[model samples]
Target: MTSMRALGRDRCLQLLASVPVGRVVFSMRALPAIRPVNHLVDGNTVVIRSNLGGALASTATQSGAVVVAYEADTFDLDGHTGWTVVVTGTARLILDADRQARYERLLHPWVDEPMNCVIGIDCDLVTGYELAPA
Candidate 1:
């Protein structure tokens, strides 16, 4: 086991910038669900693209934005060296067409489907840690 130190908000965001893919945790059908997604960090916001009618997109479009947790990690199983970052915040659908387009250009998803639905999560509570043997 190794001791972990807390990472500051700035450091967390910086680490996140280097990460291209993350897991988005949200609620669907009254149950918690998580999906692997590609994202782009725009300032303090994390943006993701999804199908317009998908569960993720629908949650963002609902009233009173959805509370989401975005997590990304890099680690080596043999060495156990890396960092894990988790961000919890409100997520909403990007209503502005121009802004949506900008996000789409910045984030490239693996899926071939059209990423017309843009969801942005405000990095309100950024928490991260580096894992290394003491």
Candidate 2:
């Protein structure tokens, strides 16, 4: 049997901040798409930097904002003990140059691509669960 423990909102954000990489789920061409990207946790948001004119940027550029679900998790293979966190929010492009600069400095892109666009996702709904053997 397996048991699940709910994590507090504050603790969920703490876990999110501890990780640098996460999967962002969005809609592309009416289909669900998942992209693994590196992100930084701002006060109440997640910041991701990508190519200014890339496909990922268009998701937020074309529309004022896009609904997305971001997730980060880790589990012990042998122990079957781990935690998973999911955050659902609206992702919007940060057009302000000043704020973009600040986010860029905080979230460095891992890929060797010219990342000039910033996407900020508000961590409005945070849910996390710890899975362990019962």
Candidate 3:
């Protein structure tokens, strides 16, 4: 039997901050879609940048509630030990000038068009799991 482990907020934040890339999940027309994104943890929120196109941008603009999942795992065939961290939370578009500026400093846009938009997810409800050699 395999046992599941529950991770605390501190662990979740630590894992999220350590990784530079994650997957953002959202629904488009009742269909689930996942996109890879580069994010940064700002205090209790995760900030990411994107261009004007894409389902993520459209969903955020439509004021749709989205669940952004940031996950990371490590595994070795010989060691048979690894861990995974997952963070799920509501997502929204960042429009405030001050907040946008701060997020911009923390998350640099890698794409063209200056990444005229930003998406943020508050880490109000975050959970994770880990499996390692005991």
Instruction: Tell me how many clashing residue pairs each candidate has.
Output: 0, 0, 0
For model 2, how does the per-residue alpha-carbon lDDT over 59-98 read when each residue is reduced to its tens digit? 7888889899999988888888989999999998898999
Clashing pairs in 3: none
Model 2: lowest-lDDT 10 consecutive positions: 50-59
Cα lDDT, model 1, residue 93:
89
Q: Candidate 1 vs candidate 2: which has greater TM-score?
A: 1
> For every model shown, what is its TM-score relative to the native structure?
0.94, 0.94, 0.83
Q: Give stretches of model 1 more than 4 Å off.
A: none
Error of 1 at 111 (Å): 0.8
* Cα displacement (Å) at residue 14, model 2: 0.3
| lDDT tens per residue, model 3, 32-80 | 7787778888888888898867778877787655666655555565766
Model 1 C-alpha lDDT per residue in residues 1-134, reported as the tens digit of each score: 77688899999988888988999999899999999998888899998888988888876776659899999999988887889999999998888989987887778889998778888899999999988888
Error of 2 at 25 (Å): 0.3
Provide the lowest-lDDT 10-residue window in model 1.
55-64
Ordered list by lDDT, greatest first: 1, 2, 3
